[model samples]
Target: MLPYLRRLIRDEDALLQYSAQIRGLTAGDIYIGSYFSVAANWLPQIIQAFQQAYPAVHVHIEECANKVMYDGLEEGRFDCCITTWRPFSGDWIPLCEDEMVMWLPENHPLARAEVYPLKQLCHESFIEPLPQQDTDVVRILKEEHISYETRYTAIDNYTTYRMVEAGLGVSMNNRLMTAQWQGRVAILPMDPPHTITIGIAIPSRDGASPAVKKFIHYVQQGISQILAPR
Candidate 1:
């Protein structure tokens, strides 16, 4: 491994690429914040692709609750953030839009239904995500005039998923975020159907570092194309 590392460092193309990435990138440190809901699916691919193109740039990720992540960007801690909801003001690069769906424990009675009306879920136990301000489950229900009682609250989104897997409650999750994996939950489309935008909120293109600009371009060129409607 050491020998291979030395060989890679000695390669002319690698050296040139590394040098080029550092030449104009400010701080050489790119901090990215992310709301976990969207990050779980898309962030890994974005990071992997970006790192391959700019190996010299150091990317620091702060994965947190939604609202907090947006705050972090405003506080100048993150050059950009990946979130489900876009605010009224921000320089956004839309990655993809996802359908909001219902998740039920395996074998739960409602799992057999082709679709679930938001109102029909009112009587079942609901698991609200913690920092509760960040997650959308509660907000969606409230907006639809559906009343529910919370049986549990989870700080980690996956922990909430686990609680659902345990048959404790039902909840809402995104289609793209959970696309390739179902885990132990049964996914059903919502009756009225809904969608959420998932994307990056950057400080601004004019004010961003070269590295940030390159990353945003990379995501737009690569990730967005993959996520394009078929």
Candidate 2:
């Protein structure tokens, strides 16, 4: 056998012995890709708890917009993804469901309304992330034939919130994104109450590594706790 191949086999054997002796994992690596909103709102808390349970594990997170998250997952760049939309196939596990809301400037006319209808905002200037590419918001708007003026196109949620705060325009967002900017923006529940189910998309439950499985369970538990009855 080649010297390199022999050395690699020897190293693998040593690693197995070392792992058996320690009774602790030596390599616990996982990659997660998800929207920035999920990363900003919930990931830190979840990671803190996860690390406490498995100190040896290493987690790498990629924060992109929704479409990027999905693309990364399909490309095998990520072990799993957290997103509002579910995979069309049967491999996904549902985590949580949240209602969508309209985010408007504090002084905007719709701020005083209990609920904002999509049709009413047709003429209002809209601030959204990159249409179709970055997010699915544009598709919904276009499907409804809601004519809107694009005031600004932000790259991420923070920038979107900043633009809204500056009274640049109104926008629609999920509860996860809107919750963080609650006091700064006027959050009005949408009419007919559009809801998005957020969940983890993995390759397959049976094919997941131990670390990945643990993290998925942790996420589900954390979300359940958050949504539990008060």
Best by TM-score: 2
Model 2, span 14-96: residue lDDT tens: 45545633785635567888767678888889889999987777889998767776766655566788876644442678787
- For each candidate in the order shown, give its overall lDDT on alpha carbons: 0.72, 0.74
Structural RMSD, model 1: 8.3
- On lDDT, the leading prediction is 2
Clashing pairs in 2: none
Clashing residue pairs in candidate 1 (N, C-alpha, C atoms within 3 angstroms): none
Give the per-residue lDDT digits (tens) of candidate 1, residues 12-54: 3334544665675322557778766546666678779888767
TM-score, every prediction: 0.82, 0.83
